[model samples]
Target: MRRGAKRLLLGLAAALLLSATAAAGYGWMVYRQAERAAARMYEPLAPAEPPLAYAAIPQPTRVIEAGGGLGTAGSGQSESAGRAAEPVSGPFAFASEARAQPSPEEGDPFTVLMMGVDERAHDRGRSDTMIVLGVNPARGSMLMFNIPRDTRTELVGRGTLDKINHAYAFGGVEMAVRTVERFVGERIDYYVKVNMEGFAELIDLLGGVRVDNPFAFDFEGYHYAAGEIELTGEAALMYARMRWDDPRGDLGRNARQRELLQRLLQRLVSLETLGRTGELLDAAGDHVRTNLTFASMRGLALDYGARLRDVQTTELAGRGRTIDGIWYYEVTREERDRVRRLLADQLR
Candidate 1:
């Protein structure tokens, strides 16, 4: 080979090596940053308390049994059937200590309870939005539904029937989780709690998101048209918070919240947003708390994400009633059973 040609080839090789080194270093930095952010966001529940005794608590007058056992006809009654027999006790039952944690790498189906808490200075605040997601990678589908903030149910730790959202205000995440598990009749594999106040900043960090608005409405000085619309951080926050004008009230607002979340998730996993990893991690570190570790999160992104193409959303059906001058959304036992079946089926 000519001397000049040899020099040119060496130069190209050196440049390629330098580029590879730089790429590897950047990838490591991102991974380290994610680990740190996950550490910051990690907030596990305190030691699990023994399952609460439901027989001691007062039962509602109406008793309704679900059609059949939550098991196959030929098979004997399932574990879920035993849990369902004692309506009050079964739902509130603590997650079994022996239950194995589902693995994303193995593509095991799992459930996540997402809570959006409206916290303020010196106040713990309530979980204004509670959404349960059942993800089945094998089925390439996800089932999502919102539990109305005002749905009247027995507050697990408090031992009183009240608005479901009050569980957070009364006992924070642990209590909130237990209450929700009772309400849904399924064990939640994980939870992600986001401070609603800081959620705006996180949305803004992602350069905002686009969502389909069901109808035109003006909220908090922002006018949302009846079609697809782009929202800034503040606009999205208000959009999710407005419930008074919504004909369905909290139910309607819940639907909008679901829409916002679905859109946000879609944006978060997009290539465009991946470029802003540092900013997103910082924002999430401050605003979000979850039991999910960095490794599990990476697995979910790499393994289960592409398979979860279908997203189905539904709301808990209930009616509003006033008790002692206070209004509450009341859900029936049968309806709760139906939700349980839906989630169970999704996991299976």
Candidate 2:
């Protein structure tokens, strides 16, 4: 062969080899990204107990032991106090009684109360988005439950009947988790509180995500057509935030939020996302807060990751009513029981 032809053949062979190598290692790359993301994303629970003994306080209706079940008993704060203080920054004066729950393990189906808060300056923010994700590793399946923000329920610790999202505004993650647990009649294994503004940065970090828009409408200056569109972080935030124009109102908004989240999860674990690990970590650091530790994250990646591929989402069925001139979503007792049984069966 001529020298030029031989050189061209060599280059082609090299390109093919590189392509094969990348294809073979794509899954491994994604796994590593998950591992790394999980590590940065592990934000442990640090309850702000006002120098009170854990034993002296009345245990929450559902008790979940924290710190790997060793339990923090006395007055020693974590060295990373600044970081620990961020998630629970709400007026927790009356929230001293709330405690963390035990971390779930492999084969143990666990529930997580996901709070997506629209925090404002100096305010802990209302949990505009509330979701319950049930992970059953043994069964290899995932379940999602959307709790309407306006749902009127007894605030677990505050002991007031208010909007379900008020728990977060009143007492932060601990109160939110406890309130949701009591409301659902199940112990929440974990909680992931996300700052809505920061979450937009996260969505942007993932280079945005694609979702099927159910209806075409203009929301907060962002326009959507009746079809699939790739949403930027800001646009995605708007996509999840709008509800007034929808005929179904909050219910319609909730459906869109769930769809966006489901798509976001799928994108997070993709090979494309693996390439943006640094951006992902940056977004996680600024926006996300969770009680999942490094060890438990590893377990999640190893045991539950595969099962999460096929997710089943359920919306808490309820009716809207005005109480004392304020709107509330009144979920029927029968509906709550049905959901409870469904989750229980999945966990089993």
Best by lDDT: 1
lDDT of 1 by residue, 1-348 (tens): 111111111111111111212222247887677777777878877756545332222223322237742332112222222222223554354333344668755677888878766667899977766778887877878898888777777788777777888999999999888888767767777787766545555567668778898899997689999999998767776777677888988778777766666666665555666566776676666767778766666666666554666888877887665544566666766677687778877887
Worst 10 residues of 2 by lDDT: 1-10
lDDT of each structure? 0.64, 0.58
lDDT of 2 by residue, 1-348 (tens): 111111111111111111222222356664455445555556665553232111011111221245544333111222121221111112212221232343444466777777666666887767766788777767778787788878877676776667888888898887787777667756677777656554545556667778898889997787998899998767776766676888888778777766766676565545675566544544554555666764565555445554566678788887665444566676755687678677766665
Q: Cα miss at 323, model 1 (Å)?
A: 0.8
Regions more than 4 Å wrong, model 1: 1-26, 47-99
TM-scores, one per candidate: 0.79, 0.71
